[model samples]
Target: MVVERRSLIIDEREAASWIRDGMTIAIGGFINSSHPMAIVRQIIRRGVRDLTVIGPASGGLDLDLLIGAGCVRKLVTAYMGGEHYCPVAPMFRAAVERGELQVWECDEGMYYCALRAAAQRLPFTPWKAGIGTSFPDVNPEIKVFTDPIKGEPLLAVPAIRPDIALIYAAHADPYGNVQHIGTGFGDRALWRAADRTIVQVERIIPNEEVRKNPLATSLYGVDAIVRAPYGSHPFAAPGYYIEDAAHLREYVAAATAYAKHGDRGPFEAYLRKYVLEPETHADYLEVIGIKRLISLHEY
Candidate 1:
């Protein structure tokens, strides 16, 4: 029998307990966009090591935070970028440069492979992407071949079923129905393709409110819900404005300074503020007030 619809609202500690060592996790976010930074902070606090993190475009404060805290072991991303000069996801470049992190840089259709493979509960999804690009350089084994069901040139991608898919929403009902006004691509697919899904909502409301709109948040396939305030920031997605300019400017300067010279002190300082000191992303925001963040940077 199917379970009754209910949202599992949890504290950071309880929500973090859901994470285990060596689990393949997925984070939802874009360049300085709507990522589940709050939950990510707690995951970092737990210090779970040797985890594989996957996402579409994760170059943001969240990526650097996790990589700097040393929580990420492997990363699978379509791409990453920052609002400033260079990419924010230090994990990708650091891994390639330091030879410690394993990365799988997939192509566009690989997304099709990842989403479909997980959603279908299949071993893998075959496709025609990354045939002549750098993708094979990362995943040498994954390739295009004949489909077992049909004779055709097909590439197979291993099921990208994430142990946990952490996402953020502008609003959520008490029942865990989430509404995202903009850019919903792959949002629902990520959760439906994972073993468990956790949502951090900006506002909490009743099911009646959702029913008021035909485009309200959908209620199926949610496992957990968390109510948070201003969850987006240097991590806010497109629909939201940028969170902090001063910090972002500092980060860009730091990365560029490192590139120009051999000093990583400034970048490390930035890391200290967002990664080491704060227990949660919310705390980090408190450290840098919303108004100040705006004053310091631009969207």
Candidate 2:
């Protein structure tokens, strides 16, 4: 078989353009950490609407920002909140409570299983997690059937196949091979499940360097790669920087103010300051300030 190689390097704006209206988009991260926030910001700035957003167990600023910007039509996830019980995701909670957003809730296992089914090209996966529970009651589409041999009912979860998936990585090559540090969470599965996968990396290393340690290259099937330092800002990228706790607190406060007082001022101001004003990811970093960013470095 002749190997085909494609140039995967792209800018943030181009990466955002890959997304269109009414697409099922999967974003990779756990809670607030390792999210592709830079690309998420670009997506918001472009004003893409009617997206069905999916993630693993939890999402923090990344998910909240998209929802707050009125980009999401539906959310399918296990949870959406801050890390370590810091604060509930104000925008997500507000939308759900007001019944403005359609939500499909599931446990982490069910969500992962659904993705796995999609990766394997299966119609659905069977699990016992939600059988005879309130999950089926809430999500009536989840079907249960009796196991032939075990004589026990198993829940059937439909495959979660996104039109595209966005993930952040510590390093990547021009060919789209990605290297992730720490627990990769559901990134690998998310990439495989999506029809297209885009990765935002801190930097691109030489292919030889990526080949030296094969174990670190856990990601495949990546469709595009963009070099994005501090791509996961406000969310920790292991070995690169610590989470910007102060900024996250500010975001939580802004969202809370908007939800409680019907004040869109703070949130809108945040959008202007972070997403709208910045022409590029470098511009966003400048707005974040060099001193603060330097302080966040793990080294």
Candidate 3:
């Protein structure tokens, strides 16, 4: 039987409520590109706990935002930029070291493996990855075993069936259906790997936009849609417009500082003022006043 998909539309704050403690979530992004930061910040401000974030080459302003708020319990990703193994955003490191968080070394096939496992309703997948290397040292959760298919030794990773998936798209409709001209990756992988999915789009365009693409998401796949401006903060880099270098630097500094303080209060303050309390990301930026944040680092 083909399962039917449900649909919903919600605002940013309402969308964030889908996140909760100890739930794994697949986030959309590729390093410092095309991230869903405004939503990430709100997830921080709202104080969801013990989150495991899986992304492509993550670790930057968006990551700092989550770690500083103590929301991230573990991170399965390719890289953590700006600090090695964690100096700026050391919470993930600390958590893992202290046995509070499980650090999983991730890579390209990670997206495919996780989704496949979930779609097939299986347990940790067994496949050879990072063999004869330190992946085992970094992530003990990946059990080394023989492949049922290949008839050889392989690594098995528990299918990453996240409780929810947080993603962003170029545009969406009132019914929560989405279309991406470009910049959307792992949408199907994330959706299939999670229990529910929430999207924050730059605009709510007409539903007909999907007809043009024909391969765009169906109403059944989306759980909620949120209209967000500058949704891909810091990382999106805005085509020709300026990026938020100043804010990103400040966030990195704050995360490193939080590592020393061992508290989430400061990062929460940053998110509340710059992301959650405001009606929109622009509203937060306006109230914060870009000119003021630029001088933040000099301090």
Candidate 4:
């Protein structure tokens, strides 16, 4: 008998190619942290459209960029904003206001239940929190049901099954063992809910290093691994660097200008500068400049 081991390592472009139009895709990262921006940009560059995006609990540009680029047809998430910088994502608001996009309303608890239901291969998960609220009215999919065993009313949360999931992590091995320095949040659950998972990491460590701390390994059997140093650029990656506040402010300003005055120049210019023109991840880093990248860590 002969044994051979295969590596899951792939480049960013290839990872982006795994996605197709009309697929339900999930993005990992809570708010502006640990987002796989490199792969997200590549997806935009590839011109993949009509996607149903399942956003993280608190998503920012990772979801906004897709919506702004017309890649996403529907968004599913609890919130979309830049945290303290911006209350609501400008492009997302504009799209919703103009009837250009569809939103699947869900709160944090409902969102978790949906993903959990999918991960557990269950039809639906019943929750008591939304029974008395306006959740059923707002989201028609949520139904008030009576639990047979408990004989109590509960909201039935449906499963959110994504075709693919994109995640960013601190370290991973070629064998697809992933590790995150800080909190994984709902990311692991998102992984289990999706059919396939693609991860971009700051470093590709040795299998021995990964084996040293098996408990630290956040995920296993990831479908693809892309080595992307500072991969979560403009966002924070635990154990690596912090968010780029100046760049975020620049994005917010451009997006806000577009939303307020319908001025496409500033917003289009941003897309061209950071997204369209960057043929590769290295080019994006160059456009971000060495000084700016260094400052993220110092500040």
Candidate 5:
């Protein structure tokens, strides 16, 4: 008897279709590194709306762009600022200040606890991190309960089960085995908390290559796999390229102008140039050009 090999490969557009309105989504990446920018841009282009977004522990423009594009109705995150590029993401700050976005405030520990609870299929996880903090004060969802064993106050971090997860990996086989070179930065936990996962990888390696170092396989049985070269463009991919600081500055400047002066001209112009007009991933990449991309490549 002969058996056919499994393949979960799909294109960026098809990957975006997996998401629906009002569903919660978990994005994987740290600050501006290894984000699935190609898939994100496609989702924006598809005009998906009313999304409840769960940003990474440390996120930047990836979340901001979604908010600015009017895709997110609610945001659950601990931080939404660029690490060193721009303290606060301009669009994210503007939306929150204008009362256009609903925020589910969580500290880092509380945020991770929620995901952990979901991953373990628990109702809620007991945490002491938010014991004396203002987290429960602002976000009533975090309930304060007495610990049964320790007889101490603890916060019940409700499970944050996402409908789907969008993650980036350095390599994945056709069978949906994902591998990463360096730290996955909470991506492992994030995917586990979701009902389904779509991974955007730089390369679709052979199954044999993935088995060569099985220990490096970060995730298995991914629902979908998209081969997106320079998928994290403008953001750094661990061992692939450095961030395009100049491009990031350009975006920050436009968004800041909109936030500071209500000048939508620059910000809208940016969306038109980068996100809206690009019909495909290749087109978006062409806008970045070869020379500039080559300059950012470290290896």
Candidate 6:
């Protein structure tokens, strides 16, 4: 008997359908790089609601966009901010301040360990990442236990097995094998920990080409793959492009106004112009203008 592999190529809309209301979603990225912004836009367009969003460390626009769109009911992350420049994520801060969003704050190291536990199919993992801090007090769900072997105190964080994982990469093949160029981040762990992994890439090449460089093919256990050029727009993709600082600044200003004034006007206008108006990612690229996007690309 011979085994056959199925192609996992899918469109952004179809990728959004894989996520349902109230499902736990893990997005791959650090603060401002390699985020699956295209899929996040699609999910907003689909009007998916009541989602539990998970970010590895701190997420920038990707998490803020979802929060602003009212798609996230709960956020599980180590930190939520605009890295160093933008200070705070306006939408996220607004929601939290208004008691509209629930947050499960985990230490960055503990968050990674929890995902690793999920990937290994374990119930929980023991580590000292959060034992000596106020995190254990604020988040009582994270328990402390005595290690049997060393007779030492350790903290246990539950495994985070998200219903779906959305990630962006530089390249992928038909069989869902993906390759990322720099700072791989927690993408690999997210891919393995989620029940379904949807990868958006800049390009889809032949499977033979993907296999040729086995080391570069760092991602596996992917369920779906979509081709989305400029997928991580406004955020850097290392060798592919630089961060769109101007656009980010614009967002920060708009979101801050909304948060401070309790007015939805500026944020709504921003959403309508950027997200709702564009029927597809291609349309978005066109709206961004070819010349402007090309200027951001790395030579």
The best candidate in terms of TM-score: 5
Residue 154's lDDT in candidate 3? 78
Q: What lDDT would candidate 5 get against the real structure?
A: 0.91
lDDT for 163 (candidate 6): 90
TM-score of each: 0.85, 0.96, 0.78, 0.97, 0.98, 0.95
Determine which window of 10 residues in candidate 2 has minimal summed lDDT: 79-88
lDDT of 5 at 111: 88
**Per-residue lDDT value at 167 in model 4:** 92
Tens digit per residue, CA lDDT, model 2, 1-299: 89876778999899999999999999998887899888899999899999999976666668988999999999888888886535678898888888888887788888887898999999888999877788877876577878888999998888989999999989999998899999888888789899999999998998999889988898965889989898899899988999998898888888888878888899999989988999899999999998999899775
lDDT of 1 by residue, 1-299 (tens): 99786556776557777888899888775656678767787787788888888775444656655765678888777665564546444434655577767777676468657767888988887776555665655686476677778776666777778898888777777666778757755667677788888887767778788888847564345778877666665555444455555556676676555545657787677667766688765677788776765553333
Where is model 2 more than 4 Å wrong at Cα?
1-5
Cα displacement (Å) at residue 123, model 5: 1.4
TM-score of 6: 0.95
By how many angstroms RMSD does model 1 differ from the true structure? Answer: 3.6
> Which residue ranges in model 6 land beyond 4 Å of their true spot?
1-5
Task: Please report, as a residue range, the 10-residue window in candidate 5 with the lowest summed lDDT.
Answer: 76-85
lDDT of candidate 4 at residue 118, scale 0 to 100: 93
Please write out the lDDT profile of model 6 over residues 1-299, one tens digit for every residue.
Answer: 99888989989989998989999999998888898888999999999999999886667777988999999999888878877647778899999999999888787888887888898999888988667888777777688899999999998888889999999898999998889988678888788889989999988989899889988997886899989999899788967898787878878888888889988888898898888999888988888888879889775
5 against 6, candidate with superior lDDT = 5
- Tell me the lDDT of candidate 2: 0.87
lDDT to native, each model: 0.69, 0.87, 0.65, 0.91, 0.91, 0.86
Distance from true location, Cα of 50 in model 6, Å: 0.9
Task: Name the better of 3 and 4 by lDDT.
Answer: 4
Cα lDDT, model 4, residue 11: 95
